[model samples]
Target: MAGIFVYAETKEGEFRKATGEILSRCRGVADATGEPLVAVVVGPAPEDAPRRLAPFGADLVLHVEGPGLEVYTSQGYAWAVTSCLAGRQPAALFFGNTPLARDLAPRVAERMDAALHADCTGLAWEDGRFVFTRPLYGGKLLARAVSRPGHPVLATFRPNSLGVAEVAATSPAYERVQVEVPAGSVASVVKETIRQVAGRVSLQEAEIIVSGGRGVGGPEGFRVIEELADVLGAAVGASRAAVDAGWISYDHQVGQTGKAVSPNLYIACGISGAIQHLAGMSSARCIVAINKDPDAYIFKVADYGIVGDLFQVVPALTAELREMLVRA
Candidate 1:
């Protein structure tokens, strides 16, 4: 029987939020196609890994473990995943559009000779085929694609587009798949790993974001943005102008050149909302802008606008949020 396969990505032996998001979304596709949902997890199998996936609608969890597989090596992972798909012959394979997936998906697709789509934002069924919607030209246009019948479909989706899955009452069956890394398959060895932000939520996976721009003044000005972000449990972001001025790191930048995000709530502080900046965040479910210029371009996309100094407004808002949380 044909099935829908999902790659369950993990970090530090724990499942990433993207794993549950993709699994939940694939479960719906599997139901529509009348196919079983299968999830393949690679790395050192944590004791609870299989259990964690069952609730997300995994009919079977393939736990792939082996030496040199503990850390992410593109060749090793691709080989293992391709081996699992050899016999099952899934109708479609889903992956989160993450750094790891970007590297591994292409290799697996080449091995399976399957059609590949990247950074998809939506999925649907039409004429017995799966339709994948993805952004192009830096999100200026959206393109839809479908795979030919008799060939397995492969695609990766952006984070946060599909919400996390609710837990199911029944548990999924577990299977162990062992991998043997062929000679010359793994060319690089990871001697060390440097993690960024020990436990902070990844920017792409954040449900809410608080961003700043040149009007934030300087490096010290980000303290205000951070304060508000901490209060709201949101990730911090900056406009390209702020990064260009050396006020913040490039990783915090949000624009066409930076990471694209679609959070539930996006609060822009002192940002002028250049088209480049807007491209990265225009998909936000709700936007609130704070700028001294009432005619700022940001107001065009903002659901709510506040004309004032962010310095004063941010502090006051943070204070109110803290008080409300305490009262609750």
Candidate 2:
């Protein structure tokens, strides 16, 4: 079938926000191109995967199930994606420009000898053609890429590039395809998956994030930011400077070289806005910058700026918000 294909990435048997984010946009494109919107999940799929995904404009959900597919092995998962595309011509295969997609999309593209557009900030059908826009020169410029309409196109979409919203509802049908993976098929095997910061909301999926930077002074300084995050139910982020200083783990770092995040709100405390850092979070809907330096670069991009010591401002802000939440 010549249709739109989406990789449904789920965590703990539930769909990740990125899955819905990409599907919601592709749903519109599917309507415009008159192509069926298909979703593919590789792993132990949730029982309600189809029902939950149908509203996002999925006409069909392909649940690829089999042994050696329970954990994410590059070769195994890549094979699963290829199996879905076999015997069918997909107008385009969409993957979130995430770590997994970054690793997996290219493999599929190479196997099929397809044109792969990586790190697309925008993917849309324009002037009756598929236009993929990506950042160039360290995000200094955006280049739009267009390809011939008929051939299979592969693209990786950035998270939060386009806001997520659902389309008209439908009862999506499902097909379970089994592909057996023999041992030694993949170069590496994952024996166990460990969870770090398991209870905390993930930085990428968070709607609000409270981040600290070099100005936090030390690891202990992150406590105030954590207090703010805990009260707001926001994830804690760190600048590369702070991460290098050992004030926080690299997992919390948000920058071009780190994780790209698009949250509803981003609170940068004691961070001097560098372009590298901005590339990751500039897409946030509402940015609040707190710094003692009045001329800090972060203020330029923040929706709200506070020229004050974060040590003082963050605690007071956290206290006030805590009170408000308690009152409510």
Candidate 3:
């Protein structure tokens, strides 16, 4: 039987949701394959991470502690994981397609001469091998790939793709693991990792996202959109045009050049749905578009559409939602 390995990530001394998603997905693979779910955590072990993973489903947790790992370095992190994995020789290496995963996964695959599949939207075992499906051609096509013959098949999953539900279970075992950090790897010393200084939630992790575009007129127009977002308990996002115009920060930009987001509800206000913008948010469960132009590209894929002025429509919608909540 082949063993399953998961690379769980941590942020600000806590396990990120994407980490739990990968771990839970690996647990399913392990049960089906009759193997153990071996999860590896790089950097310091947050006190709550091990216990949090157990209920979600993990057989064994491997905590790899290293000083060099305090901040994310692509080569250093990859080296540490590759070293610890020598003993177990896992059949597959799973990662949540985060920024670090995007940088390090391919490097690890190249080092091991293993097959690599990135941004997988779904996964399943077939014919004694894993089949991963990822979007291609600007989310217009779905590509299914199989791993080549190798000791460890590397796969990175997209955020919000896997729906991992936690259930009550007996706590699993935890093991302390140590690895030697390679000194002569890539020679870029990252002095400090500056988290974007803002009060906004990250686009990839938000449950609801309210996005604006050029059709909103100017930076001042986004104020109304922000009110709607606040009423809905959502984060504000913007098209490339809005960011280019300095109407919003780059972190709030939703497009191919920015961040890919798959929220539960994505409301587009005045966005024309450029291919680049759709590429980032097409995975959203529900889409609502509001624009005066009926021919706007955003309407093509929107589940709900309203042809009207966003300034007027947004305030009315916000008021209604607030009233509904208060009455309830």
TM-scores of all predicted structures = 0.93, 0.95, 0.93
In angstroms, give how far residue 88 of model 2 lies from its true place: 0.8
Q: Model 1, 42: alpha-carbon shift in Å?
A: 0.9
Top lDDT: which candidate number? 2
Which order, best to worst by lDDT? 2, 1, 3
* Model 3: how far residue 39 lies from native, Å: 2.0
Pairs that clash in candidate 2: none
| Number of clashes recorded per candidate | 0, 0, 0
Determine the C-alpha RMSD for candidate 2 after optimal superposition of all C-alphas: 1.6
Error of 3 at 232 (Å): 2.4
Indicate whether candidate 1 or candidate 3 has the larger TM-score.
3
lDDT of 1 by residue, 117-177 (tens): 9888877777778888887866668899987777898999888876775746347788898
Global CA lDDT computed for model 3: 0.82
Candidate 2 segments exceeding 4 Å error: none
**Candidate 2, residues 47-104: lDDT per residue as tens digits?**
9888999778788999998988988888999987897688788878888877788899
Tell me which of candidates 1 and 2 scores higher on TM-score.
Answer: 2
